[model samples]
Target: MSGKYIIMFKDSATPEQIQKYAQDVSSNGGAVHQVYDASIKGFSASIPDAYFQQLQSSLTDSPIAVIEPDGVVTTQ
Candidate 1:
């Protein structure tokens, strides 16, 4: 089972750091969907259930800020 996630980075995170993180996610069998560098610093990715825990742990231990489910958000 794979789920989408919003991996937020610190406002001060460098582009290199973000890119590296994205690469790490891909290496872990995840797929990056979007990357925001201005105003918001983060990337949206689809991560496999198997590597989800490891991803959370890695992010928690890194300079990243937060991680949350990228649940569908629709405006009526």
Candidate 2:
């Protein structure tokens, strides 16, 4: 079950680090839509469930802040 996800890096994350992460995503049968290294240190991508765990584990002790599903926001 592949799905859209938002991968946010910590403030200490460098641009190079972010780029490497993007490369990892793309190499692992994922599609990176956007990378935010200015105002935000993160990226939005579509990752497959089969590779999600490996991706997360690869970043262990790294600068990654959070990895969560991308979803719509509603205001009512």
Candidate 3:
């Protein structure tokens, strides 16, 4: 069940923090493919099913925003 995820950091998050998180994801067997800094602050990564839950929890716990199945918009 490996998939891509879009992780958006808080406006208050620093570059170092984002970098650290990316490194952590890579260390945990996830592949970080793209990083956004202008007009958006986030990174796109491919996470393996084995580490998906853990990685998701890690981001949430760290207060990093995680958006799954990216590129979809819902309007009410």
Q: Pick the candidate with the highest TM-score.
A: 2
Per residue, candidate 2 scores C-alpha lDDT tens digits across 1-76 of 6889999998988889889889988888999997776777899999988778887786779888899899898999
Candidate 3 wrong stretches, greater than 4 Å: 58-60, 71-76
C-alpha RMSD in Å of predicted model 2 compared with the true structure = 1.5
TM-scores, each model vs. reference:
0.83, 0.86, 0.76
Question: Model 3 shows how many backbone clashes?
Answer: 0
What is the total number of backbone clashes in candidate 1?
A: 0
TM-score for model 3? 0.76
| Tens digit per residue, CA lDDT, model 3, 4-49 | 8888888888899999878877988888999999988889888777
Off by over 4 Å in 2: none
Q: Count the backbone clashes (under 3 Å) in each candidate.
A: 0, 0, 0
Worst 10 residues of 1 by lDDT: 54-63
If the candidates were sorted by their lDDT against the true structure, best first, what order would they fall in?
2, 1, 3
Task: List model 1 lDDT by residue over 13-73, tens digit each.
Answer: 8889889889987898899999987778999999888787886778656768998999879
Residue 34, model 3: lDDT of 92
Error of 2 at 1 (Å): 3.3
lDDT score at residue 20, model 3, on the 0-100 scale: 88
